[model samples]
Target: MSEEKNEITLKNYQVKIQDGLLQHLAEFIKPLWQPKKIAVITDDNVGPLYVDKVEAQLIEMGHRVVILTVPAGETSKSWEQVQVLIDSLAQNNFVRSDGIVALGGGVVGDLAGFVASIYMRGISLIQIPTSLLAQVDSSVGGKTAIDLNAGKNMVGSFYQPNLVLIDPSTIQTLPKRMLVEGYGEIVKCAALVGGSFWEIVQKVHQPADIILQAESLIHASIAFKASVVMRDEKENGLRKLLNFGHTLGHALELIEDGQLMHGEAVAVGMAYITAAFEKKGMTAAGTTAEITARLAQVGLPLVANQLGSAAFYRAMLHDKKIKGDQIILVYIKKIGEPAFYPLKITELKKWFEPILNSQIEDN
Candidate 1:
């Protein structure tokens, strides 16, 4: 097949999706940025794999490239790591005119994007998301964040990147588990939008099947997200829909304490919440079964059994979605239709207790 070329124009920047764009990195960067110094922030896992090639492209463009690699994983998305990167930038003299390139999965994107936002009160950022999860979800949105003791993505900013380059070939290096982890987000997106995207996602019978459809899937995902972000860049209204499973997902991720990857936690969250709401007659009948089947097809866990309802609830109390005393819960009336229900903090447990309790009992 001829290499797919798709571009999404958001409110502030552009997202270019192609199969081999990474090989022509300089061509893309040349149009949006002319910075003399560019800090390429990535994780150790990704650095060893792609940093040299990325640096070569940057160097070819006559840009001073600084490779800042941090430990790979969620733990790296912390205040101390942020400080470490800031010091590195300062020590190397990264001025306001210089740009930052986030070159890994979600953690690296979130951490480096946050640093780019605050250093010198904000600098240009370019997101070169490697992992499937990052390319499909985190990289497109421009919602950068770091985790806190309280919850995931608790500390961060709404900093848009000047450009986003997604090369699906990078996903070839991801392990099976990592690819499945990414499907959690892809499934979440499909669940929210529904229709053909949802249909396409459900057709995948195995993890490797996703690779066959990566470029098209990435394009569809980015297009849907870009449409949402263009309307509600600050997530004040329309963009809130994107938090479909994130509320409980973040809590489950926190309570699991790294045992659960972000996408897996989201899979469990989506399953539980859909089932719970369906039982209460709030969601469309059979929606839970459909979602559960899809999640199972990809080997995503449907239940987080280690923690009880109280612990999960406590973690959720710190979620960014909680507005004052009410938390907005996103659910579907049926496939292709999603609605948000705002529940008071005091009544949040009523929504999750039955499903969680049953899960505990089963375990």
Candidate 2:
């Protein structure tokens, strides 16, 4: 991809999403023919579900396909799994010019993408997002990583894909909880680009059409992300804005020991952070109620609990976003307006005390 006059002809890859996207993988991916071999990395869950269909089409198109399946879910996105994939690629004589297609949700995309990045120094990555969250969020940005014992995404890279294939119909296979889990990313965009768009999230009849009418909302979230990524592909800058709900979110997950999904904790974290955003007058009146209703509609959380407050704060302090004990929290003033909040490390222990008080009810 070359940047000519601030216009980068996104040659690296393409985002071709239409109805019935999965079966048409061969058709939509014509530009991806440069690779000598194609490795489709998926997980145990998504492979049996969609692989045969996609592979049949790829074979018909005369492409040599390599299939690599990792255990499904977050735990699979680790150094060990990545090592297995890398070893497989090596055994298969994979080359730098070869491209890897990531199939599944964010976990698959991240794990495979990191492999694509580190293997042979750098390799091309193609994204086929089977989940709504991956389609709209994770798959687009080059940000790819795995969790560390220290914190989430503590080990990763900014490896963009050569192409992003989105099949909205895939959502049909997504469990209700998975479908609902995606809304938190949507809501993160909602809170980041606060305005009447948040109202649409509150009032839209068809959730499917919300992003269409509100493309800017998605773009806003990405813009916020791009600002961070553009400056720090390594996550060294404005990218912290994307962690709006992740402070308490990561901790809640740690406490649950990954019993809940990433977005689940984020949902709870968003609800918890609302107290701080509200206290600061960043959140509009009544908006909290509206988000609560919306979250419930999609099956997200609207509060955090006291049981894991200590561990959650501990995780936050050790978080990758922390800088010398100063926790930088992303706070929303309204929909579409997000700002950074740098809190002292010493105050973090005291910070959650008032925020987690029973005064603020959880949904």
lDDT of 2 by residue, 84-137 (tens): 999999999989887788989999999999999999998878788888778667
TM-score, candidate number 2: 0.87
TM-score of each: 0.95, 0.87
Candidates' lDDT values, in order? 0.86, 0.72
List candidate 1 stretches off by more than 4 Å: 1-5, 359-363
Candidate that scores best on lDDT: 1
Q: Any runs in candidate 2 off by more than 4 Å, and if so which?
A: 1-11, 204-232, 280-284, 306-308, 359-363
Q: Write the per-residue lDDT of candidate 1 for residues 189-263, one digit (tens) a residue.
A: 888889899988877878888999898778877888888888888889989888888888888888888889988
